[model samples]
Target chain A: MSELISGSEILMQSLLKEGVDTIFGYPGGAITPVFDALYDFQDRFNYILTRHEQGATHAAQGYARVSGKPGICLVTSGPGATNAITGIGDAMMDSTPLIVIAGQVQAELLGTDAFQEIDLVGITQPISKWAYQIRRPEDITWAVARAFYIASTGRPGPVVLDFAKNAQIGKAEFYYKKCEFTRGYIPYPEISTKQIESAAQLINDAKKPLALVGQGVILGNAENELKSFLEKADIPAASTLLGLSAMPTNFRLNKGFLGMHGNVGPNMKTNECDVLIAIGMRFDDRVTGNLKTYAKQAKIIHLDIDPSELNKNVKVDAKVLGDAKVSLKLLTDAIQNAKHGEWIDSFKEHEEKEFEKVIKKEVFPENGPIKMGEVINLISEASNNEAILVTDVGQNQIMAARYFKYSKTRSIVTSGGLGTMGFGIPAAIGAKVAAPDRKVCLFVGDGGFQMTMQELGTILQEQIGVKIIILNNNYLGMVRQWQELFFRKRYSSSVMINPNFGAIADAYKIKNQEVKDRKDLKKAIDEMFSDDKPYMLIVETEKEGMVYPMTPAGDTVTHILLGDE
Target chain B: MENENMTLYTVSVFSENRVGLLNQISIIFTRRRLNIETLSVSPSALKGIHKFTITTFSDADTIEKVVKQIDKRVDIIKAFYNTDEDLVYQEIALYKIATDQLIKLGSIEEMIRTYNIRILEMNETCVVLEKTGHYEETQALFSELSQKVNVLQFIRSGRVAINKSKIERLSDMLANLNSRKPEGYVEDDEYAGY
Candidate 1:
């Protein structure tokens, strides 16, 4: 039986049909109909209101990343939709699944520039996976279903649906049917057995095989498959930044993170491997420094769901296009259990050298301003290495990526490809919403935190219990570091003169603490995470502290400087 | 990197008819800093679907990425890139010249025979000539006519292409989608409650 319902009701019904129980959004003029309908469905789903549209989007991203579901955000037209562009682009670059619904002016006023009207679909088309404007009330259910389907499908990214005001209030015969098939859109491509067999053969014969895992493994939920494949093949694995926490930190064959500021072992030993099996990770420029020489000596086998990423950057010997969970299991079944003792030992040797030359001094410095690494270590220990670590971009992010030890998949959420600052707090709110039972910790730099610190109001309103740790270096630390090393220490406009964060937190009526000494670090962290309410900790760190084991621009991965020259 | 001689690639996209899709597709080209040298949109063989033929000067790598991004659109059925050699393509040009000038030159018949042009219409003041060929061929004919007569107006339609392969890829894709169940749909029993 079909019931006649308003377009707003159709949207709410469609969302419920898709198994969505929560949405992060902000209400405004054009979206009144949706909000009115939401008022009736309040008992079915929870809507967490954020201060700004961007905050809602990031929070949705946080929820998506942690829950492995499409995060939903709703906002009104014009400024509200424009403000969300950054988050949409961030989700696109990071491959996060998000559905942003922006209300528009009446359909008649679409191009006439009516009050609170913008071409959101046109603006967001390039950045989003799919974008469309709903012109008819009859199409509401179908549009909502399509948005969810496109947003959460293969290589998930953000999708936008712009609903005209007339459609929202107009009546429609609503039969809530989830979108199953889009005419031209294929969610999953068929895997070729021949390609998998060739990749398996290469793995079986290679003496020194290294696995470069990316966030795709987590996105595909192939953690167990990846573990089994690594164990069976006896291959050493390394993670890209977003790929962190896919493998448990203490996994025997897991050789830490790999990139410009990554562990010395993975970056230095990338060229030494005979075969590089890239699983679910695109070779971004940051991950592969100087592509001309990146893993040049290795025979590469790339396994990914997206066909475009196969030879986009680094040329590969064999390509297996399919979901990671399926392809990895097939490769594991085709290969024999073997061990490369000496090859693994070589990576260990490099790790030890890095620890002796860089990690020891940077993480365990004794008599100076509290280092960023120490702060991350204290928080990691206080949370028992189990908290979901959300970080903003800059030195704070790189330091946290280096110091925090993750024991679970989907535990670390950061803006990876977009390198978006102001991402931590709102995303941490989303993570807390998605996984309320787990502890959520946000590590943000002072510069990045100030970009979206207004989200403190969001935390206060929602009572989200996220632990906020601000690494205050009194400057845009990452840019400052770059200037210091490469540009004769000109400093530029990186210096940020700021307000007292503790006072700001107090104004928000949330608990706050400050740590300038090493003695206060652990206790402050314990106190911050001790309460279920949101708390902010400001840690003063040395201004000139730089991320080491750096691969200068235009240089090979192997040519890395262990320390500041 | 700043080479002048970049190969031109023709990208064809098959999509369902929707407003603003052209704007969306054009934005991708704008973001990549690639200019669309020519573009044409018309109904495809499919009843409700449309085909967009776009030409841009870029390398194979960039064109491949553009096609992949275009394919990501929900309404887009499929997008493919082809080099000049892989497809047989043609463009039509319409030229309007002063009737008095053409008659005075007394070379309208000679020009029509030489360039394989057709007279679309004629009036007391002007005549319209249609030329169907490659872009360069059309341009060359227009130049010769202009040198001899007073050209009042000149317009060219974008390239329309047909792949050398016998089978239409879009037909195969649509058939494949038809053979399968719609995505994300649950059984009727499962949807009874919600």
Candidate 2:
């Protein structure tokens, strides 16, 4: 028989068995026992005590996105568990694997309105992939194993393990059996050969074909497979926001980004393609402007691991269900090698038109207040296109996503699905922790920067090397942009009286700088990337700058506005 | 609610007998604002597995998504939706009437005879009647009795459904689930049959 161990030890052991060495969390009433256990095993784990529970969950999400491992976090019950809800929802939408262990009132006191008592499971059920409560010591091993298994499987998402006070202190014989199977759970669905063949046939028969890729390619570790399929079929590929880093920016068949604020070429060409192959991407409303007018001319083919995502948005002519790597390889093998040089060249005219109107001006502006794009472009060059670009929501996210180039896979980490603000500081810290050797740069707006600026303390304490570039526009830029076009520029609650970010960084004992001129942008970025210690560079950006080449909400993808007009 | 796309659909979900599973399933319907017309839970033919049969009104798209979401649960084995025409179904209704008052309504026994209702118990004060049929048939019997005599209490069971594809498909699926044992896996002894 295995040696008797406390439930807290068993929990620690189970996490270790799953190859987890780091945990981001905060302590409170119900989870004190587990924290006490950590006192002894401190050398074995890098437990990060984040300033807030929400920051911990977002940090774990960023870790998960970068490492392809299920990020683990712990917090005490009641408000602690509730605080993690937004991050859990973000992880759910992003398909980022996270295992959140929240403390609970004792098994006996549960539902009695006891101190720190909350229905963590009930609250997390919708947002989490699975929420299981461990009420006894014996359940710890299996529950931990199950939580990791479910959180990291097919479409990765957050799993909450509600550890009760009794469970934390209860003693039981430790068994290290890994949960590889559950009776009713099917993590991976078999790839249907018939679906593959029909999809290949559609690809082969198409006159002009385009494929839009999403984060599933990176999640499936199918970047090479996608490249092969795109090359073999000679298809021009566009990327969803989450799919930014799946292919290198300089790849031959790479067309551009897709969505509301995406490039002009892909948005316009979406209507021109005869066959639209949606690979590893759900047709989010952002990508499909007006469903009625979006891709009506094309025969839609969707490929995803989740069956529900097949026809969830737009009806598809074909459904390829399986791991993307497997399906893409099958497709690459099934379809005859061919090239659509003339068809591929059709997007170039639209690209040059956008370049002259938007890209050239945004990134290469000669003067005026500092533009957001120039900062990102300078960072990309300064870091040699090797930095993992993380961003807070709004203009900075799209600006960095557009201007920053990626040379590494799994390099773009952001809250894509939920679009949560205050996600940047902690997420970038977690990213740096996950990839210590890789440079990590964050592009955040002034409004979002202060939302979770408390995590600057986490960086200083952990000494995490995350280069934070705050694009201070003195307004909630994305909302203001929308207000400018859609809301008649009323600017309700969009403007902000900013904080002294440099002083905040100084208080946190981290290196800091601020630049207002365009010429100083390159030098500031270079300085931020020079060393392996955390640095924050605040750049005062264009107060009223707008992200152009936008397909107005519910407007057809083909019809886009290049300028504010 | 009056949209032409709306139609009655029976969503049958098979899952392990698990705590909070019902609430999770209910949330799926509630979130969509689709009211559950009827819901029944019972042990399935397979040991350790329970089946929940729910009937609701939804458009084709919403129902399809709802069933898929139900099937996505970790403890859930499978979920399917069928129109009334696709399933052989029935609901059983029970009626309790005051015996003395019931007899005063002329031709009540004759009406019961025509409907093939079985009298479960009778006393000086009351009588209980049971009828099994489609929803409308059972409702018709209840309405007839309520109109003529006082129904002390009336109750109706949720619809029980079986796919017309035959029992072989069900057995085949059960067998298939049993065969799909992942590595280092064993069914708990509580689920003895599997």
Candidate 3:
């Protein structure tokens, strides 16, 4: 025993036990003791002092997102703790694993007008996966351990630990033994065997079956299982934004992304499918243009980890709630090979006919501005078929989904639920941090890049080599496109007078290049890829460019407008 | 230095009974130093609660730190400025003036109306007048009417001092240290290492 230690020490000890190497935090009166204790452990743990509490939280988010480790941030009481709300909400919406520690006024002083006191647990309750306040020092070890487990396991998200000031100073005997989490709250609802059987039945009987993969597939690492099912059943697949890179986009039956901004092949086929095996996706509103008419005739088979999500949106003929990997394995085992030759023929014919419907205009002038496709394609080529592409949410996110290819699960990180701007660059920095040697390219929109422009400092400071490809459209093209399609072109507050990204990179002493034409895209990327310092490529494109084939909001998926048609 | 230019300061406010008054006062002060010394509230005989005092050692220049914070709290009806020697002030005690004695001096009616003193009770022999205000103001009103009526015993509160303006002890200490001959400055705490 290392003598009796305070709850704050136990919290730090639990982090060490979990092999957490670093944390970000700011100090204040209520949390001073924790920082004081941390002083002695500085050699064992790296603590990054942030300029602001929110900065610490976002940095932790960046660390966790890329490292595949639970990110941790510490903040002092009252306003300091409240400052982390935005970052916590970001983590919650993106389903990233993060741990937040906030110091509270002493238990005796709680609800009293004590100095620097705030009700942090109640404030953070709605935005966190779970929030707990430790009034006793003895509960620190278990609470910290449980926080890690809850944050990293299942569908990951942020968990908060609100520690009272006294708990940090009070001493108690500490142990490092790991204990099993009480099963009562674990919620091990078994996957329905009948539903699995029904899923198999649907897979065997249907023609033109499409597998719509989402983030859950990556969370479950169901790529191999998914591929096996797809190959055995000859089913084509389309990925959601979060699901991008869950399956190799280069595969023969990959339809790419399927939604408003997705590929023509996936969107058209999604409407034409007879059986849709919607695996690991929650059928977000973005994916289902008009819920009533989306996959109108297709019988749906939904598989997810959270049972509550099943039939919460579109009613399914079969709903399997277990880990997607396990569920897919079981469902595949139950299926026998059956050929839907007529369905396959119809899908291929429809794909070709729709492919012909595209206007096929060479929008990029021969030597003029760089097209978004050309940049994405060059990055794909330079990647040598092995790099992970992380995308920010915007038109770039959509373009990457349509064009970028992935070879493994969780190879890409993108904001799906929150559609938060500034997520891409930091998340890319995070991905690079997680997979140091792998080439990681961040696809960001000009609008989204500005949200986290400061993280470029961290990139230079840490010397993390991440290739940033900024699509300079000068507007929030996604929302603007929505405005054009449905909101009567009232594009308010969507346009951006973006700064010169190359200049910004130069200010950070980062190597950068500007791509003006499709012809220069490949050469620019190749030249930048050879150097090690952080590089940014700004591709200036048309100002009012709109993502096509947009399904108007609240309208049927089938009610899509073809720009030329 | 402690009396004229302290690094920290606290001040107390006595006000009419009302809701959400403390919040308004504290927010203004907290927004400044984000520090509070100590605050106490209790009932006084003048039909309102008596605020004890703040013992902040800060100088007059930074006194706005306290005043601005107090303004945001809802309960405080008004704030007053005080120097250490201006009046003998104590936050404790209640004083009552009687009407029968004022009639003898022939000054009771004018003083009572001007101060808006309430008549708490009446009998054949005496009537009690209740007046609530700051200790100094109450005392002033008490003295002006003292010759006219039989003076009753008055209660007094503890010492709560506000420093004169433009003196800050901590800033002076830092300035003094900086102006001294060159010496290696080693931080006393781990945080100062930054």
Candidate 4:
């Protein structure tokens, strides 16, 4: 017997096939049919209703970013779909896997000036990795499958599917299947064997070769292979901002991050290394400093999944285009295992010396709330290396990078390229939903948390236990940090008026705490982790507290300035 | 200059309207800049779309780069550059000559025949003379005619030229992106099981 289904069923079926267990969304006129269809199959999936469409999109982004799975979200037509623009753009810039299904006015009303009708396909074309408008019921499954394929594969990004009202209602046979996209989409780059040979040779011959892993390693689930590769090659490794947690921070060869505010060992190693094998990193201008002098002593070997990245900026002595896991595994297998115990020991020696010289001196103002570093270190210690740390942009991100010794693969998820404010809480909510067994904590600043604080309602409604620790500096600390350093302390528009965050959490019916002193911070953190309810901790900090060892924008690795130096 | 030496010319062309107008005219210029030279609605071209024919005034390699940048702009229909010696070209203009100097010009009839100029419009106070030929020839006439008659209200409608040689346009980039099929191209089955 054959069964007939509506286009909405096809959309739902495609999400199920893609292993999308949760979706964050809002309901509206154009999307009523999707909601109705979702109502029937509610057991098959979970939909979290958000206060706004933007929250739904950000939440989806957060889930995708942390889980390395395709995040799914639904929204109504016109304004609801348009509201997801910023979040979708953020996901695009950061290369997060997201499948955004937006309802549209009926096929007949698509171009007409009908109520709630808009050209969603045209509007989302540039921002999304791919977008499709389904006018017929029969094409719904194919379009949605195509959306997932485009979104999850290659360089992951947001893909929007505009389901027309009539099409969602019209009947069609549902057949969920994987599809081959044979059009203006060539996602993977072909890595030449010669290129692989040269890259492997560089790894085999280097005296101090460091593997700078990025988010791509984690996204591809290649962390285990990378760890094995590092162990086999006996090469020390560092990470980029997005690359944190790809290798466990406590690993013997892990040298932490290697950019402007990266760890002392990694930053120093980048300056001294003879060969740097940058795997899955863009060598972003921020990471490379001045491109001309970036790694002048080294022969760079760049291995990335994207072709455009190869030789686009930093000249790579060898460019390999393949999956980081697959590529690293191959490179590991080809080379004979060798020992570089002395080189590894040298890294530890430098780390210890720098730790004594710079990190040992911690002079706080001797007042109010704890320093951001103290909050981060205390929380990192309390969480016991199992918590997923999601940070909003600014000083909070920098402090988290400095203090958190991320020991799990893909444990830290932040909006790296987009650096969107308020990305922390919703992302934390999504991350908690993705991995409920693992404790997810949000390290957000007072300025960044306010952007999407409304998602606290969703957290409450879902009763998902997430610890949101807000560093109440009363300013957009990163901008204020920059303004203080480079802009000569003009302090414009960075300051925030007193916000009753504890009261706001109470209003949402979530448990709230205020940590007023350094000792109180540790107490608040302990209580937050032990609590079964959604909790927010307001840690009051110095108004202009800056994260130190800051390399001014576009400065080299050696051009770092420690605070009060 | 050596026989092999060359430079590219970035030309701005303005012309009259017709269908397949650009393809017909630009077929003459080889190694053309790929975008029209900022087409604007000229008071000429009978108040039609002002088309630009942008090309580099250097060697073929320089013109290739110039063409690539210009071809990307959506507004431009066509772009190409050609050497002055290679193409049949023409520039046309209308000059309203003062009637008082008509006698000093010895007769509009004699001058029109001598310079291959056409008398498009005539009035009692002024005579409008039209010329169509190579851009240099038209300029020469415009200069020589001004000597005899006070060239009142002169308008150079601009040049429309093309290369006499045949050349194929550059290949499309979108086509290149579509034709690639690396390993693991097909993740799904050729056909789903029944």
Candidate 5:
């Protein structure tokens, strides 16, 4: 017979059974019972108390993205649950696995508009992979195990569990068990061998076959398999922003990034390839500019885990549904070795021209304020291409994607789909927590940094060793760039009279430095990385600096502009 | 062509009977800016589970995404989208007419035979009639009755549908789930009350 235990104890036991080592959360009135229960389990799992529920959620996302495990978060009801909505939406869009447990008002007080009462399960339904409200004490263990299973399966996403106050305090007979199967929920779809064989036949027949890789490669841990497939077939590959680290930057077949502000060759040559093999990417509009003209001539092969993604965007000649590693291995075994040397060299020629016209001036500027690109380049060099780079949205994100060369998978974490602004610092904290031995670096813009700057308190409290570099452009750089190019530089509300970030770091008891000169860029980065503690470096850059090679909205990828027109 | 191309899709969702599952399904429609023409919820053949039938006007692409989103909900066992021609559907409607108007016109008997509506109840003040058919057929009867008799009230239940396929999808899914169940976990029949 099983012994009886409180719902709070059951919650703690379920987490321990799942092997959770850390959880990020905030305390509140309704959640006090669970917090008290956590006090006894402090030796079992380390809890990092964040200042805001949003920060805790983002921190959880960061940890999930780095470790490929379900990140756990807790918060109170009403305002606390509402605060975590953005982070939940971000995780859903980016396919990050997270388990968020929220404390609700007592069972009897529910729907009575009691204090700290809200319909968290209903509110989070559209955004979460699953959302449930636990009513009975016996359901706590079942709910927790189910939540983790749903969060970490298939296309991973966030799941919310709302615990009624009474349920937490109530007692029930407990037997901790892991949920292995969910009715009607198929986590992994069966891979069809016929589809794999057809995909191989198409790849073998193409003269100019190009591989478009996305975050699926990293999620599947299929980086080595993808590398082998690309080399065996002699196919050049380009990465979507989130797929940055799937292949090392130094790989010969790596054609660099592809998108609005990506490399010259990848964007321009997308239309030129005869066959386009998309692995684990949904072909969102940003990656495929103006779908009417995007790779219309290419015979497309889409490989993704989600069956719904097939034929949703660009129609493909063949569709392979399964994990990237499994699908890639099948394709590699069936494919014949062939050389596309001429097609690969054609991309290099375009890269040479872009390097002469744009890359040279941006990375090795001689006389001006420190350019954002140069700072990213210096940091990339100083970090030895090993640090996990977490970047915020807007211009800073694009520059980091452009300049930083990652040599490891799961090395770049950023807000790709939702493009949330204040995602850098909190997510960096989560990444550092997930990978304590590896160095974690953050690149955030002035506009985005201010959105969640309160997380500096969490950094101070936990003493998390994340090196943060804020690119102080004194304006919303991406919006300003759009205004300059598209709206004739009206610059409406983009400019900012920002505060002293260094001083803010000081107030939080974190070490800080400010560098405005180009000569001091390397020295500042070296100093920041040399320290064993948390440090924030503010690098002031030219306010008018813009990310170039942008394909204007609704335009073809071939019509990319190298600079402001 | 654009107006004609906009199709009406019927989405059927099977889920466990949870308190807020209906509100969650409605929210998905609201987010997509699709209006719900009709929504019906009832218990399924399987115990402890419910089924929701929702109708919306959208193209194939939008309906596909909506079905995918609905399937993402934890309680939802499965969601299927079908066109009007793919399903056998009907709605029950009730119409109340003033008895004096029918008596004065002397066409109540003839109208009942022509429209295939049954007289549910009759009194001096009013006569209640019931009809079972597609929405358009019911609306036609209402229009015909209005000209002949003074119509007092009209109401229609939402659509209930069954796919033309021989086997029920829910039974197949449940069987699959049963086969994959781990040890010590009970089936839906043994699920404790919420």
Candidate 6:
């Protein structure tokens, strides 16, 4: 037997062995044992005390997305675990690798309905990759190792480890072994040569091929391989919302974003392309628009690590089921070189039409109230596309995604699949922690910012150097826009009577500015980014602003509404 | 993943017996709106492996998806689905009745001969009868007994199934893995793979 150690100490050792130096969490009654042990282990760990357990999870997700390492978050039982459910669901949808440890009531008191008790494993089971309860101290080492392995492998996802209080205090022999190959859980499926050859054959023969990329390219670390594949074949590619920054904004073959509010060209070309190659993306309904109409003319090829995702949304003619990092190179090698100039030019025509009609007005407005896109576009220009663009959900997120440019991979951090508001502030802090060298600029709506405004305390406490740009339209703009379009402009509970954000920032002892005029906008952004410390730039954006190039609900991907007409 | 093309499919899930593993597997079936017709859990031939035998009605598409999801669980070894034609199955049931009520019916030996049941235990107050057969066959005896005399206690085991093939799928998979294993390859721990 190895030397006996307390359950809490086993957790610390297990975490340390997994290369976790930074921890994001909230401590509470059931989890006090772990926190008490962490006090002695402070010299080796950097513990971030998030105001809410929910914030911790989103922060962890942000960190994971940026660093390519599984984020570790700890929360107490009961309400603490329940609060973090949204983030867990968000991580599941976006494929962010996170290890969420929720403290549970004592093992003996598990079914007694003890104080602060929660059935954490039961609640988290559906959303998480795995939910295991550690009722005894001895299970810590194995569970932690397994959690890390299961979380960070294949299509990465969140895993919850429910820790009972008794287990935290109990003593047991400690030992840890890194998991290499799990018996049934195959993270990396064996790549098939037949599939690769077939994929190559289809792509080589296609006259009009469009590559619809997703975040899998970034997660698989196949950005270079993807670029090489696209360049070799000279195929125009567009990215899903999460798939942004997999290829830089200005790459020649990189068309634009895809989805409902995405760039017009990519949305239209999706229907036109005779052959659609989807890499590392599930055909999310938002991206596909309508099942019956989406890519009906195209022979679809899907490449992903998860077999379940292959026919989940769209049927694939050729399925390359493996890590795209490995498969893309093989696919590139097998395919014969070709060009689709005329096919590519068709996409360009639609894009040019979009630029003339919508992009110009959104990004270069000279008069009237300040536009969200204008500020985003200018910030991209100001940062020289070097800063990471993080956004909270709703109008701000779409505008930021549309206008903000990128120069690097893992640069776009936003809650895509589970569009959780208030994801901005905490996620930005996590992003800053993951990439201390890079500038993390966050664009959040006033409605979303206040949702997790308590995280502002966390920023001040840690002095995280992140630039926050709150697009204060004074309304929940996304819903308001929806109501305006579909609900006959009856804005029911969409508008907000808010507080002084500048005052809130001052109370937190952080530098802040409110930009109401266009001239002040540039200066305010400059001031926000001038210093390394936390800064919030509150921009008074147009309350009536709408995100356009809309594919009306159940409409075809190609038929987008450019304006009210 | 549920669809209208419903058919009887037996989904066998092999896993390490773990806390809440049964609940996790059941939840998947519930989410797909597939009702479990019969279920059983028992240790497998292989050490440290537990097998869950579940019978449910679902199309091939839904079952395939559900099996894939079940296999994705951390401790699960593998999951497979097969139609009734692919496997041989059986179930065991027990019936306990008052001796006085049973004696009132004439030709007790004739009843035993026709129903294919054996007496497990006989006491002053009650007699226990055991029957092993498919679900319908067991149910037929249950109907006859309930009409003749009230059953003091009745219990039925879930369906236990084995593929009609000569070799088990798990054994085949292990053998294939062994043959492909590098020369002189040794496991770090005997139970680690499980």
Candidate 1 DockQ, CA atoms: 0.53
Worst 10 residues of 5 chain A by lDDT: A180-189
What DockQ would you assign to candidate 4?
A: 0.08
Best by lDDT: 6
Instruction: Give the winner by TM-score: 4 or 6.
Output: 6
lDDT of 5 by residue, A395-436 (tens): 999999989988888999999999999999999999999999
Q: How far out, in Å, is residue A18 in model 6? A: 1.9
Number of the top-ranking candidate, with DockQ as the measure: 5
Question: For model 1, what is the alpha-carbon lDDT of residue A354?
Answer: 87
Clash pairs, model 6 backbone: none
Reference-based lDDT, residue B146, model 3: 68
Q: Write the per-residue lDDT of candidate 3 for residues A1-565, one digit (tens) a residue.
A: 5699887787788889989888878899889999998988999986766556766676677677657788888999998899888778988877778899999999999899788888777676656776777888877876787688778766778988889999999999887644333221232336778989998998888867888988777767688898888888888888887788777867766767766666666677777788888887888888888787788788888998765467667888888878888888888899987655565555565455444443232132355455565567668778875777778887788667656667765676776777767777766766676677888888999988887788787777778798898889888988887787678999899988878889999998889998766677778888878976688988886666655556666666666665665
Question: Candidate 1 docking: what grade?
Answer: medium
Q: Candidate 6: lDDT of A47?
A: 92
Interface RMSD for candidate number 6?
Answer: 3.3
CAPRI category for model 6: acceptable
TM-scores of the candidates are 0.96, 0.97, 0.70, 0.77, 0.96, 0.95
Ranking by DockQ: 5, 2, 1, 6, 4, 3
A156 Cα displacement, candidate 5 (Å):
0.4
Considering only chain A, what is the TM-score of each predicted structure?
A: 0.99, 0.99, 0.91, 0.95, 0.99, 0.99
Give candidate 3 regions above 4 Å deviation: A22-32, A35-67, A113-117, A340-368, B1-194
Instruction: Give the poorly placed runs of model 5, Cα more than 4 Å off.
Output: B165-169, B177-194
Q: Is candidate 3 or candidate 5 better by TM-score?
A: 5
> Per-residue alpha-carbon lDDT of model 6 for A195-280, expressed as tens digits?
99999999999998999999999999999999999999999999999999999999999998999988888888888888899999
Candidate 4 per-residue lDDT, tens place, A1-565, comes to 3688888877788778878789899999999998998998889898899888888888888788777788888999989999888788888877788888888999878678789887776676556766677778877776777777778887788888888899899988887766655333455556577888998888788888878888789877889988898899888998888888888878888887777777667776777888898888888876767776778898899888866566666777987888887888878877768788887788777677556554554323345446887787778889897788888888888788767878687688788877788788888888888888888888999988889888989988999888888989888888888888888999899878967998899899989899877766667788898865688888887777767666777877777676757
Query: Higher lDDT: candidate 3 or 5?
Result: 5
For every model in order, what is the iRMS? 4.1, 2.2, 23.6, 11.3, 2.4, 3.3
